[model samples]
Target: MKNLFFIPFLFLVTIASAQVQTGKASFYADKFDGHPTASGEKYRHNKLTGAHKSLPFGTKVKVTNLANNESVEVIINDRGPYVDGRIIDVSKSAAEKLGFINQGLADVKLEVVDPGDGKASDPGRPIEHVAVDENEFYEFEISRLKPKGYGIQIGTYQELVNLMRLADNLKSSYKKDVTVQVKVINGIKYYGLILGKFPSRPKAEQFREELKKKFPDAFIVEFNRL
Candidate 1:
């Protein structure tokens, strides 16, 4: 009876581990080097690690680039690729190995090889990718975005980690709430980092002036559309 129970459990684990997802993959930007990742470890572009919207941190995943048929195994140490349709964000080394470093993005398949411990890997990072419905990851900012509000738009980036690192730095420097808004325009994904939600446009403009000293391109944005 003991042996029978163990066998069934092992079979179930096998089935779960075999589950696969197919979507687009991208790589970390150089600007993220030395920044804290969701795993609480500083990110190194050379590390064979990745970020997924929902995968538990520390999980080992096999990522296969469909275009070139190149595959690389990476550890999940962060959360994101927050853009719509993106499934995974690999480190620079992983991108180079997968043959997508120049292209910057590739369609890929992901298979979980190891399910990591279920715990908050980075307490400072907010959990933004919960399943709100079947087959979709919930985007809090996009869903709850107000038609009219004031926020300081720092910069837009194609790489998620570059945007995240900017948000992390703003949070550390200003000790304010920072948010990353994902937008897909003309079939290209852009991550926009916004800091400090203000109720009035004037208040937002005032802060934008202060931020302009550091981020010259920073400006106020009024959330109106996706």
Candidate 2:
């Protein structure tokens, strides 16, 4: 009889353990505000809510920006991000809190806090509480270190050689000034290939369009130097 009781407890633990997922995350566009979500709630850009494909509505999740190590707690209130390769779509406010509002997308990890069982469950207990380390976080703040300006980022890579090779190709092919910026997030090194600083966003956008022909993934980025 005691063993039978243990089975149910084990089942819940299994469910909880299986809820962590990692992938690319993006935020809802402004157009989605006030729209009906799959969960029957109206989308609100300011809410710390998110959309997940399978997690039950009301499930709380802790989303950590793997690149910057910034984490935000949000409730899963909708379904999707239907775009390929994305795991979650966060609210605008959540994205801002995660520090990926400007980038539009970020690599993230999602840990399910409560499974929406309607039971009071402590969401923060199972996860090890590590002191929030801001040392590494500030190191990656590009705007803090460089003058604020617009530039075109062609790509980000984990391998330094790959980043250098791409930068070399862009410089040689277009005879444009290319720069490699390195950022370390969550102990992983990323090299970003950037081209030309423009004083205005319009100038940067124009150049981005031209670069798009050669690099389909290229996009404009703003650097706010602190």
Candidate 3:
């Protein structure tokens, strides 16, 4: 019987080492504007994504609050919960699902369900690859995009034209891409102007510094993409 147990124990150990790992973590919410996230995607508060220091982008994680045993599946999209000793930065929705919104933070357990390509996606870092032109009009930039990322928004306005103008100005100054989008809420339209699908906060903030020269009131927000 002892020998039989030994075989099972070894098997269990091997499986444990081979599969993904889990650890205790503390989550954070989006706090500032113009902060880039790990996976070159913009950060969005309403997203179901999260930031982990080491997990590869596009990896899925199941986070459970040990205190309450509340669990939620968070796709690893960004690079951090940068604070020391913290393991992840979860979206507000994930925190809410984990029943920790009122407390603002919680001690949770995070298990990597997928390892991805072993790189946590950050928005600031640009990965270059071959661009394939499928046709005269379509050019496909073929690179392994880690599928999830975070970005910071510089401003949101009630007028689409104003947002457009701001986005244009930012693009001219930085010589980079700027995007504008319109959102409808309760029949009212609002426009959002954002910059840098950067992978890291430092990179986003660097761009934010330039935008400040023209738009003093610009603030930061998060955007996420699947």
Candidate 4:
């Protein structure tokens, strides 16, 4: 809930996975139910289908709510979410399962579980495909750190005001030590917010579940004692 400096959900997951995309996601409107989609199939509200800017019509993608870590596998059957900063548009049912139907927009990570035929879903709608690197972002790799215990990274921001604002709020609300980690890229400075010093990975992980209620994208980090 800050400025869209391009960086999205603040969750870190370790796994053997596909190219993960971090961005904002939205659900389809109820009015579009039963309407014809780009793939020539009718859009059903209950179907676990979604629209991507360029993935083939039948590609299966796993969309994860970075905030809450909820995930849903949906088949790509349309092309859209034409709005800037948004990565995908899922069916209403998928959105409900992902637990973001009420918020309408959720910060998410997308993994292409299965690549479908590399053919256009809609000839009428030209593919405005953007490579993963083309995504706008403010987060950057930090200089090596020698933190003691583990930490939880909540979010990163281009605006120090936003970063500090969140840090102050989180510190007071959670009663934890807050740290602002800085990194510079192309002369632009970015800040990463971290909550500190959980004695062990398991301790940090146990606390992570509680923080997810508010910062769904929060993730564990190493060398956080610094």
Please give, for residues 78-113, the per-residue lDDT of candidate 1 as tens digits: 778778888888999999999998899999999865
- Please give each candidate's TM-score: 0.49, 0.46, 0.42, 0.47
Candidate 4 local accuracy as lDDT? Answer: 0.69
| Model 4: CA > 4 A from native | 1-18, 119-226
lDDT of each: 0.66, 0.64, 0.52, 0.69
Candidate 2 C-alpha error for residue 178, in Å: 60
Measured by lDDT, the strongest candidate is: 4
**Between which residue pairs do clashes occur in model 1?**
none
lDDT of 2 by residue, 1-226 (tens): 1110000000111222225778899999999999877666788999999987655456679999999999999987776777777889999999999999999999999986544321112222222222211111111112223435787877665534334334443554556656556666666566666777789999999988887755666888776631
**Alpha carbon lDDT of residue 222, candidate 4?**
73
Candidate 1 ranges beyond 4 A from true positions: 1-18, 119-126, 129-226
Residue 200 alpha-carbon offset, candidate 1, angstroms: 67
Once fitted onto the true fold, the runs of candidate 3 whose alpha carbons sit more than 4 angstroms away are 1-35, 117-226
* Candidate 2 segments exceeding 4 Å error: 1-17, 118-226
Worst 10 residues of 4 by lDDT: 1-10
Residue by residue across 165-212, what tens digits does model 4's lDDT show? 344445545777765566666776767777866889999999899877
lDDT of 3: 0.52
- Over 73-145, each residue of candidate 3 has an lDDT whose tens digit, in order, gives 9877765555655667788778888888777667776765543322334424643331211111211122222
- Could you arrange the candidates by lDDT from highest to lowest? 4, 1, 2, 3
